[model samples]
Target: MGKCIICGKPVDGLICEFHEEDVVFEFEGTSPSQLTPGRYYRGTVDGYADFGVFVDVGDHVTGLLHRSELDRRLESLDWEPGDTVYVQVLDVRDNGNVDLGWSIRQADREFRGSLIDAPDGEYRPGERDAEDESSSADDDSTTADAGPSTNGGDATPDEPAEPAEPAATPTMEIEEPDAPLKRTTVDALDDQVGSIVRLEGEITGVRQTGGPTVFELRDETGTVECAAFEEAGVRAYPSVEVEDVVALEGEVERRYGDLQVETETLEVLADDERETVATRLEEAIEQQARPETVEPLADDEAVAALENELVDAATTIRKAVVEARPVVVRHSATADGYVAGAAIERAVLPLVRDQHTRDDAEYHYFERRPLEGTVYDMDAATGDVTSMLEARDRHGEQLPLVVLVDAGSTVESTDGYDLLEVYDVDRLVIDDSHADEAVVDAVSVAVNPTLAEANGGAVTSTALAANVAAHVNEAVRDDLEHLPAVSYWEEPPAAYVDLATEAGYDETAVTEQREAVALEAYYQSYKDKRELVADLLFGDERDLAAHVSEQFRDKLEAELETARENLETTSIDGVTVATLDTAAFTHRFDFPSANLLLDELHRRERDDGPFVTLGLGEDELHVRTTTPVDVRELGETVADAVPDAGVRVVGGRDGHVEFLVGERDSVREAALDALAETLA
Candidate 1:
């Protein structure tokens, strides 16, 4: 055997058939020559690193380039594999494995590389491949091929297993049948609310927070809760997904907290049959939409950015949470309006827990502007401050000034104005012990002094340190001091106040008010606040936070707009703007809608695990759990549901879901229904 191809050895009898082939494409190292660097080549991208793309050209030989090798000017381009690109050979020292090269796509147009040269080695046959096949064939014939043996490959005594049940007729349609109650179409059934009629729908949600998987299963009519044990729940649909549409048979049992439509059975549709169901649902939703029109609110890129911004906003709100603090409670009469008296939208600055009532404030006001001789009365039992006109007598109109103060407390204007003397006005003896301790704690500082017409009727000598009015007319200034335009200090945030009192904290300590974010953490992490907000807002996906953000913005914008407009007309003379610095109500805005959507999506499928949100476009919407929610199907579904509705479709971020028109509610509904059908 002068020329035996297998093993490259001369042999005669029982020759191995491998190690022989017409051509052998072998790679040796990380060089260009080792690769089939043509316009198009096949290989695995084994590893990806921050530095470059690691390609398994073959034979465990990986060539690392600044992914730029695939397309040299990579920094200016977006490239992803399996994308087409050009390459050329440079060096391959170790046989044909080690390779180095440049991108043909990145090379100059004038530099036309030559074609690959064929090797000079003569034709040869290989026996290794055939031997491998033979061995593999032998292995395939073993019992293990069926799967791993249960008893160490040893067969146990065969036990008589029960015969499997016969398959039911394929076209099993779970339909709603008409009864004596009413023969109404589901569209018509809604009007017959109290009627006991059959309604067929697939399960949409299964929230088993504590025990069994309890979820709402709905169709054209409505949703109902269905519960099952752990075993039966898992066994019902081994392949059940979030968007699987399933038919259920149940009865309506509506009662607070127990409102549910019971289901006796849950049947899954076959894969081939689901397309038709999804298609039908899609058609229905489209039917409800404005079929021939849609306007893009924002592109994919814009929406992504908006989503990131939302998360940051939410985080900022969270950071603003603060512990409840001391506040004064006083009752005052609601003045006759027309004056649209004392309007301050920021009155309820921070929200306390619902278990407790919101902070209430009271301010005494003179009906007409005071002409310097205005006297007020202080009720001893109530600590109520009132003017002489409200003294309950006309001839004996002498007024008693109510003095309320906590000792050693200080109150001064932002301009460094002290008004301790003003709180020292004479008390005309309304009650024997009118100045009580309860009154002192509530009023931080008070000024009740007998002027005795002192030296030209001037005020002097402060009674307390904080009471600037007593010494220098410390009236704590009126609401007018901090009006539409007030000094920054006049209304500093609680956090900023801490900064103000701190040794070296001031406007210079933090960024400018306009440039600053409410959250210190975000500011600390992102050096550039504007860039951080823009980057997070413009280049991200809409997640769960985005949805909440949308709700928050929608609500907040409405509230703010209304308040701002109303404030323009209403005059609030006594509202202390600086008092709002300590208020924070972030937690009150919690809406479980986002979590609920995610939970619902998860219950429909086992793998979905928990709720996860992704921003598809500018909106943070639930992923369409249902399959085949293409644009066409979406239009159809909208059309069917609301015949002439102006519809806009958006791809889902989390699941394979499709949303309806521009209207948030309809889109949510269509997507949820589609999910029901998909994971039915």
Candidate 2:
């Protein structure tokens, strides 16, 4: 019975995930190539899930090797998790999750072994040496854990090592045991139960369930379920990311015949060495990154360009937990042909939620809401649906594919997803070689940019929020004085109103205007916005025409682009214009009700240059842009246009709008900067 020479856990119960693989033999079509289903092939276990191990048997295809199919001796195999091992595909679900199975009992003479076998004899004959006792004693601590931090068991435990460089600080701290601390590595918690030990890794699950907050903790050693009793001093859990290394302070709590560590404290780990470099690099990169080229953006591209900026400008809460805002949602998956008996392209699931809201709801006023969705592929790219590992070989990248996903987000019992867009997928994975960022730079060949490209080379808001949360964690850990430094603060908009009138106009207005109906205009704008979003974020050609009619699609496309471009930056003196252009042509553009006359004067500074226009005129309001930047007189001047309508002029010392309108205006004007105090 072979065991994981490190953790001493039964391979049968342990899971394997496919991160690296080699295409031993080329398949026929560049498309779905079929081979004997039952054949055994060598590959690497990327990682594990509750369902099974994903084995990368080359061919850019991975197989799901389920735990049930593996023999009891699976507990003893010394194969490196990412290092290659023989695997047999059991089943590949349609939902993109894969399962694999391995058993020494079922394997040929090459793999046959007993669980009692140690790492020295079967797995690596060369690793065993007479003088290797020192290496064994020091390295055994790592055996209990195998993950991104593992480097072929070569870690020198006797020395305090220097941290390397990643774009972010990747260090995590481990709170030592209170007493005779079990110096066992995380992987070692697997077998022969003893006093629970402490290990640190990323927190994958932070779900409050079964009367306590339970989470899945992972490190190079392996993954284990962790539960908090509320007494562990963890008031609230941090939204740690999947790839991020977090410091987990807890003890082993075995339950249901399974061992899962229970955690109390979770602290952000800042690998100080890399923090300086990553922080500098991050700032440099942002300074260098430019918005996607625009100018001829069609209807969809129009809004997307703007939306892209909003996504970029949005306040990112590093390692923050925010839902995805899917203005236009679609579904797709990565599991195609390898293990599945047939190709299931037709099968699709709801990939995301629609970013819309009901009228008058508190959350309704907000354009972007929280998003909740599942990731079909862990290594999927930004613009493409294929996995990054797969993209590496196909595109011949200089670096191994690295996808940043908040894969660690968890809600209740639902599995969390990562909003990853491969801005830079580095290096090629050739026969499992050590590829780094430098190698990828050498290959520096560019492929079509993914979601980042489609959305003007920016990540989605969902991604931004997650990154922000991560940034927060890092800032705290790295003690980044520049970050977490508040430049401004205030309350949110309280007396805000929608731009369009909620009357839901009819088509009769279209006949009178000789143009498409306002409803058609709005719908077309919506469709175009969604389509542009699809193109920008997913690189999918989801068009606005799909949701709108041809009659208005051509007409409203340009306006939609304008509105999208001004996203996030549309705030005029802190008053967000919202989607005014789109609402102009929609069925119901909720009336701002904020004293229309004042708004007219507010917009006077628009394009007319030096006109001091005033009063609400025929089908339009007059604006006076050349007026002095004085507040009281502007309010009084604007008050004249209202007749009986309330006029309100806002802003501070610089100036404000003066018009005639309702109490909504004057009162709102007084409360001007109050609403935008926060981001102002």
Candidate 3:
């Protein structure tokens, strides 16, 4: 009988049943069947395979430590061949194969006491000494026949055999190699499959999958995926993140027809090594992200005039993708806004796919969100901030770059821009509205023809975005050739019309596509609906556009008929002023929104003389003027004339103002009287 080393309780072996897991055993037997299941054992690493590592428990018995049984990724283990490790025998199959499970306690000092599992029985270190002394004394009579002692001491027939020295504790010492490994580039890895190499670069992305964590490593030459495992579905190295400079050693292998590196050792570079790699990546990215020239999709004086700003905006978007920063696009909820946002989306998705190794990279890296109005207000910015912060906190992602299309050009969006600035987020604006000069100074890049004083007639937001998209990725130029014409409600420019015709879309086809997008844009004012929008704009479903357009015309014509019956017209200073009480006569929440109905009514009722259309709601009023009217100036004049009405301009780009609902009649009278004097 023996005592349990942990509790000092009397037992039949060195450990009791309750403390068997506490002590690690050294397997002294030579066959797989000798391994006792649920007992921890010391072993040596033999080699590696794709599924697991082979370990030699003794001279003749070998076991497999499968990747699934590891607490961390198999590749992340730094153990080389012949190195000592600790594992538990999970099972011994009938075919003489032993299965091993991971052991959290790896070192000899972690256990209560080390013991040997021999064919006879288990014994502690001191017990082995007593057995050696007994053997030498008992075998003295056979010394003459044996003639020599196996022990390292002289023995003669006349002299008694000496006791063997106290047996020493078994230990292993590993030596580190004196030479450093050779470094290799990602581009050169294809020729070195099945060979181990070292790499130094920046991590562009990190994604956790069902099996391993895939880190996208980028060098000056190219990019590749390096996989590391700590456990099933667990992150291999939690400290490493995107944009971190790293030195990695791994074996190059092919997985699912794509080249992947199985990481053996990964360390975040420091000091001089980090600086050298960072500078090289910076220089390469700068040269690749910026296009040498900006080429317009078609010959238009307006687009040519703002070439420099277009290039700058395109470069900013391209650099965001290369750096693995998400791109969030915000645009107005209108046909022109949808077309503009979709054009850029079409160009950016291809680049995201090329840069990332993940299958869902396009959706993760690029997003398009539609705004309720043509302003990036605090509500919109708050939603964006919440989502972006969540992504960064949960996934270790970099903050995104905000891109505004057909919006964010006026002073109302300054507060939203300021909120993003607090987090050091980048912003880019592309619009055709009369941009406020303050907006130009707030964002990183602003592309507006009005800022450049270009005289080309009626430059729509879609026109500007399409040219920028072409420059961002010229491969998608043919896909965007017809978008500019679809954004125009009336007669488009001759150049865009010809371009659309050459792309196989006629005038009717373009109009149908525009109307369909506008209807879908109204239903879900905030969601992206990427797939549905793509089908409407670029898909081959002709009947889809036709069907949606039919519903758009039906809904619009009915609203127009009801509005014309309620409209009241009067002449003020030789100008026709048409007014409709939208709150009383219109469907406030349904399709053919108050704004769309008013636009159609004005187009049908206008004459050669000066004309103005007004749609008055409970608390707001929409304005449309044949001549240029500064809505801001008009609101100031009316507010002063009717002080009790509390009138103020709420939306400058959309030409709308707000007032107290209680004094709706008084505000209406005062606004008309103010308009009479201004027109006169």
Candidate 4:
């Protein structure tokens, strides 16, 4: 008999049956019945299909490799007809159909031994001389529990090692039983610095720096960084990736004030061992990291109904942090949007720091993106998918949890949410906007005032987000309590104002922070500007908020002064209607975006006898008024009066309406006439 390559146990051939499926074999059989189920075989690519690829395992036997069985995209495969490839026979149906699974090993040398299918339902060496009289049928399962061995014999009991050649799967080196070293948790590494330690964990992130490949590993207790230096910029352990369960041998060392492991050896665990470790880690995390019930931020009737969803949103975010998945926050580009997004960022960064040992964990784990408009569209979703998929492929990072704040409440966002659902990425929407009923179905969690039967007008995205943020990380409640006040453009909610006052932010400071964030939000629009935003909103140095606020006031005042000079007024059915040619009077490209300028202009004009500010641009008209105007009603009236205008209430909740300027003069005249008729 030949000995099993692993464990040095005597078997029928070079490898035992327990490791039969572990190695790639060349099948000489000609029929599906002759194929051994679960054994990987060298196959030839026969053809491709939309749903799968056909591979010829033998002259007459063919198997289907379904796209679902592929590790990556089917289109990514470079195989052509007749190309030699490797696939596993997952099953052979009684009808002579074979199902195939992708095999990671492509080279013949990666596995030990070659087995031939025998008509007697046994596996034997292709060369008869390789088998001896000592071989027996019971050898298959007899040595299944054996540790790794080599060609000559097993290594010395004191220093167990892997075979010189690559095995079907890399496994941990069997340590000497007498020289036992217990596995250490990451949280205990602080005390174990400068000492050799063994650790079992999953690789949460893998990054190749100039000198070392840094693997961010997380156990049930905590997370730590392990560095494996093979050569400068060269990838060490090409088979390992994020989410891989591993048994690592290393020395805990201090690097630049942080604890890191200098890896001596790292091994990816086998399937069964990996599952056991993963299940244990998951159970431990679930026990310790489960979110607790959050006390309501306020007992307002509007907030009461949403208490459950608020808790759920916070819970989802907390779970993502514990699971090492990045949280992506998408918000509108307005002051309200930025403040809401910033509040979530504030809550999440601290949790990331507490959970991870990496100093830059906050940046790596949390990101905030500002959207162009109130709708989450396909363009934005496509960009997010592209970037995140690249992160998955390059670093093996888990898919991110996409949180939409101040947006994603309408049917317009359905397509975007659908795209995300295809990848099974979790989504959360926190907004106070008027929502379509279908929106709740599109996201994992929908925390909206409208859905909870609360008055949407009584809520703002900042209020919803700030409350969720507070519950997400209670330590940042003091920092986030002032955010809602900064989001209001007109009447700040009394509750938010009272809360801000208690937090020590007076009226002026709130205004300054609001203006500063709005100004900064306009510049980048895309980037989160994590540090810059933190400084502007929460910093005391350089009077950053004060400085940006001053700039905001100057620009806004100058624009308002110029706008008032050019404003023309008329009485329309008892309502004093104000009109400004935004295309002519306003600096469309300068400080204070058209939306902000128009909001302020409308606010200022409303003091005089129920006024309305109609800022007419080249192809669009934005309507804002102090007089209570049913925007949807007025839009329908205008559309009826001026059929060519195509007017509609685009922002129903904000009392904002839009219409095409196709017939600009006609549209304006019709809008004025419609308002006059309504008021009359």
- The TM-score-based order of candidates, best leading, equals 3, 4, 2, 1
How well does each candidate superpose onto the true structure, as a TM-score? 0.19, 0.25, 0.72, 0.68
lDDT of 1 by residue, 1-680 (tens): 44434344665422223432121233333335534433222233332322344344443344444443554443334433322233343444443333434443432233322122223322222444676899998898874666544444455347433455787879968988754332222333324334344443344433321223444443432233454435421333334434456654444443222244444555666675656655654554333221122211112222222232223221221111111111111111111000001111011122112111111101111111111001121222222222232221211112222222211111111011112223322211101111222322333233222111112211111111111211111122231121111113123334323423352334432222211211211223212122233222222432432443455445434543333332211112321111000012112223222322233223332233222122132232433222323433545565567554454332111122233335545554454454344333
Q: Pick the candidate with the highest TM-score.
A: 3
lDDT of the structure predicted as candidate 2: 0.31
- What overall lDDT goes with each candidate model? 0.29, 0.31, 0.85, 0.80
Q: Is candidate 2 or candidate 3 better by TM-score?
A: 3
Residue 503 CA error for candidate 3 (Å)?
1.2
| Model 2 poorest ten-residue lDDT run | 337-346
Tens digits of per-residue lDDT for model 4 on 1-680? 77766557888655677887767766767668888788888888765543567777775567889888999987688875657898999998776778999998886777665555544434545454446433643475466646445645557568756647754776889976667578989889889989999999889888654356778788987788898989755678989988889999999987534689999999999889889889989887776554565665655567777988998898889878888888999999988898999999999998899888765567667888889888888998998898688667655578899999999888778899999999999999999877778988999999988888885357789888989998898888888888888888768878778888898888888988999988988886877777888898888763889998899889889999999999988887788888989889888778878778888888777765667778878766677766556666777877888776766665454444566756788878877887777666
Error of 3 at 123 (Å): 40
What's the lDDT of the predicted structure labeled candidate 1? 0.29
True lDDT of residue 174, candidate 3: 88
Top candidate on lDDT is 3
lDDT of 3 by residue, 58-137 (tens): 76576889877998876478975567899999999876768899999889999877889988789886678898989988
